[model samples]
Target: MGVDAARGLSVIGMTMVHVGPNSAEGLGGAIYGFPHGRASVLFVLVAGIGAALLSRTDERRWDARLRLFWIAALFLLIGLGLQSLDHGVAVILQHYTAFYLLALLLIPASPSLLFGLGIATALVGPIAYFVLRRLLSDVVERETVGWGDGLGDVLAGLVLTGPYPVLVWGAIVIWGMWIGRQKLTYASVQWILIASGIVVAISAEAISWLALGQYGRPDDSTDWRNLLIADGHSQMPLWLISSIGSATALVGIGLAIGRRWPSAIWPLAALGQVALTYYIAHLVALHFLEDRLRFSDVRHAAPSAMMLAVLGIGFAIAWRRYLRRGPVEWIMARPFDRHRRREASQNPRP
Candidate 1:
């Protein structure tokens, strides 16, 4: 159920990011926010949640993890190809693919260890970013190459620009895993999450104000790379606060709803059941509508509304038709199942 809600939220976030503000208009833009960067953050955090949940399931075998890694890699390749063809070189999927691989490796660790590592990574991530920025800034200045040079440069650029968010995101994943291992109905856990979320959100906002007052507007184009570093007091803090706050709020809301009306879980569950499929489907649909059809303007309204309606109705229908898996879910599961069969054949005693 929680997974379902997370999936639905991810779709919402994706829609906002792809649709952009100009197209969305007043209410739509307000609901999503300008730049809509936070939506992707939410999607990544929920991804952590889903990964944690999967780690707890019986399907958490080596072959299963490898297959998932390959899937992420495939997406990463697609993202890279798309960037090379359409946009320049600022694609995100390569980083996502790297993060996915890292998550797969870390997912099997004990929750306590994972949580401790998450905390350590969060604390160190910014500092690492700062140091890397100094080094990379030199390279960029010396070479006089714009950030979007070659694919290699872009990949390197991501090491400094990209790793920080993934570090924080990895922590969120660990936190989700810890939550997954817990007794779900505990009131104290809920209170703690809510309180922590509020405090973090407030702190982030306050810091952002301070930074803006001292350094200038958050979007000031002094050096685009500085935004990724901690010294700038812009992107890092804002991202941390917003992502953590939104993720916690989501968990709190899900728990509250789960307790209040159990049957309300259906739609979210249906969405979650086919999360990977829907995620890929969204990319494909967005590409088709905006790129192939050349109806980028229509994307402002039609795509989002159509996606929402389709997902809602499709989820309802899917729930009735299939008891456990979504269409994509069933497809992805096959490779893992085959691997399991091979393992079973080798070790028949178990």
Candidate 2:
């Protein structure tokens, strides 16, 4: 339930970042900056936890991991297809697919191992990328996100140049899996998450303040790479800490909500169950706006985003009320279901 709630929150955050205004003057500015890279971080973090949970269940059967690989491939394909829509948004799902594949390799690791690796990656990934970018012969810097770009360029976008680089972003997922192994339903665990999040977020900002003030580091200059790392440049150590801590805090809040307002959480829970459905639906809505309504300006896109998101959740609740799973989820799982059934028949449990 907490997982679902966190997922729902990420979806909403991502939508706002995509469709809301872009300025630093008023409410729009606040809303625009809220999700920046954090929403995608949370989304993938939840995915890591989900993968861990799935692996646990798969302990009873052998084919689950194989199915996971197929699912990852499908997501990669779907994400690339969404990019073909050319919605002017840097979608995370493309990189998300690659992270899933990378995460799968570590899914069976113990919780301690997951946490250790996550921390190591968060600390070292940026430096490694910094060096590798130079060593990769500036290949990543020249690349741009587009359907026409070469496959090599696209791979670089997923790995190094994109806003959500898999190397750093995937560490959040690993940490999330570690958290998922914890006693999430406990109030003590929730408090730790909340406290850690607030502390780390504040610390990151304080560091940035010092960098820009006492040290006289210009925020615009890329020379001091860590200056604006908190919420903008996600490849930095502080940015990963701030964002993953935010995600941890969100999951904790979800747990609290599940305990306190069981009824109120149902709608978002429903939306979370069908997160992929709504994810794809939003891009389709954007495509429709492009093709039919001819809405060219993002300044006024908030209403459309709100309408589509509301409609998507509303339909999800209505559909889930009668059906077991969302349409796309059902479609994705059917093949695995059939295989499981056939395997069960072939080796009858005596």
Candidate 3:
């Protein structure tokens, strides 16, 4: 329930980042900026935690691995298909598949090892990306949104240069896997995570501010000095660290809140449970409304986002009353489980 609530918040935050009012003045700026990079980080981290939970539940290793493979394949196909729509937003499902594949290799690893690898990725991925970007400047010139262009371009994009490069973003997922393995229901653990996350987030931001202030931001976007700043979507080490910390803290807070007052967060938890459906639905809505919304205008931003949330949350709650899983989730689950589906159908949810 805590995880679902946290994931719900992540979805909502991401929606705000996409449609909220963008003003550099007053509370609107802070509201618009708060979830910029952090929402995606939380989203990815939650995915890892979910994978870990799945692995823990299944008794047969082969069965779990097969399910993960199916999921990855589905994501890859769907992501590629979505890219063809030219929806404007950089779809992350392809990169998400990369993380799912990576998880297969690390699922059997010890929690400590997982944590170590996550930390190493946090430290090294950005630097490696920087070096690779410099070296392969000509080959990977564009953002490389989809594989329709070429295999090399898409591979480079998914691994290093895309909006959510698996190399750097994988750390959050790995750490999330570690978090899932922990005894998260424990109050002590929750508090520790909250405190440590706040400390780490603050320290990372402070260091980034000091470094950037002292050296000054360079005109060149590719300058190494740019890496020192912790701006959202910059994909720098500091940003990664800060995002991880903030995400951890948010998850911890969600866990605490859910434990304390489960009923209070029912809507959020319901929304989280069907997050994939909401994500896809929102994207489709955005695509249709793209011209009319005029995303650049502040007037439609907040209203659009509010409408999305209301519709999404309402749909999730209504759907959950009749079905155990989301529509997409149900399709993903039963496509490979004919026997399970038969038994479930016979028994019925109620």
Candidate 2 or 3, higher TM-score? 3
Badly placed stretches (over 4 Å) of model 1 are: 22-28, 57-68, 81-93, 138-158, 161-169, 185-187, 218-235, 291-316, 341-350
Best-to-worst order by TM-score is: 3, 2, 1
Report the C-alpha lDDT of model 2 over 268-326, residue by residue, as the tens digit: 88888999888888777667665432233444556655666688789988999899888
Clashing pairs in 1: 4-268
**Candidate 1 — worst ten consecutive residues by lDDT sum?**
139-148
Write model 1 residue lDDT over 1-350, tens digit each, in one string.
65466556656555545554423455654554532544455556666666666667656656548765876766565555555443222345555665666668876677788768766765566555545555665542212123356777654543445432454455555565566665556767666666776777567667766766777653432444444333212335355555656666666566656667757865665665566566655556555555432233443455564565377548645664755666656665667778879989999993
The per-candidate count of clashes, in order, stands at 1, 0, 0
- Write model 3 residue lDDT over 181-246, tens digit each, in one string: 888899988888889899999999999999989999856656889689888877789999999999
Clashes of 3: 0
lDDT of each: 0.56, 0.73, 0.82
RMSD of each: 5.4, 3.0, 3.0
